[model samples]
Target: MSSMKTYAHVQAKTTRWKLDSKAIDQGIAYGLMIAALFVTYLVH
Candidate 1:
């Protein structure tokens, strides 16, 4: 019973980390796109 609880806790923590990582990746992608657009505008 205790082992099952521990397993559940670890799973939840890993899931949360995966979600956070995905969010960070998405934010970085958006930031890069904006930066690219700004640079293009400046160049032209």
Candidate 2:
């Protein structure tokens, strides 16, 4: 029973961690897009 509880806790932790990394990935993508736009604007 205790092992099952531990497994549940770890599962939740990993799920949350995955969500956090996904958010970070989205942020980086947005940053790159903005940077590309800025560069284009400067070139124009």
Candidate 3:
């Protein structure tokens, strides 16, 4: 029974971690794209 509880706890933690990492990855990609566009416009 204790092992099952531990497994559940780890599962929940990893799921949350995955979601947070996914959000971070998306944010970084968006920021990089915006920066690239801004640099291109500035060269004009």
Candidate 4:
């Protein structure tokens, strides 16, 4: 019974981590896009 509870807690923690990482990935992508645009503007 204790093992089952621990398993549930770990599963929940993993799911939360996945979601947080996904958001971070998206933010990085947007930052890259903005940087590229800024560079292009500077070049032209």
Highest TM-score, which number? 2
Model 4, 1-44: lDDT tens per residue? 99999999999999999999999999999999999999999999
Check candidate 4 and list the clashing pairs. Answer: none
Task: Flag the better candidate by TM-score, 2 or 4.
Answer: 2
Q: How many pairs of residues collide in each model? A: 0, 0, 0, 0
Please identify model 3 stretches exceeding 4 Å from their true place: none
Candidate 2 residue lDDT tens string, 10-38: 99999999999999999999999999999
- Quote the positional error of residue 40 for candidate 1 in Å: 0.9
Question: Following a full C-alpha superposition, what root-mean-square deviation does model 1 have from the true structure?
Answer: 0.6
Global Cα lDDT for candidate 4: 1.00
Q: RMSD (Cα, Å) of candidate 2?
A: 0.6
Per-residue CA lDDT of model 3 for 1-44, tens digit only, reads: 99999999999999999999999999999999999999999998
Model 3 alpha-carbon miss at residue 36, Å: 0.6
Q: After superposition, how far is residue 14 of candidate 4 from its true place, in Å?
A: 0.2
Q: lDDT for model 1, on a 0 to 1 scale?
A: 1.00
Which residue ranges in model 2 land beyond 4 Å of their true spot?
none
Q: Compute the lDDT for candidate 2.
A: 1.00
Each prediction's whole-model lDDT (CA): 1.00, 1.00, 1.00, 1.00
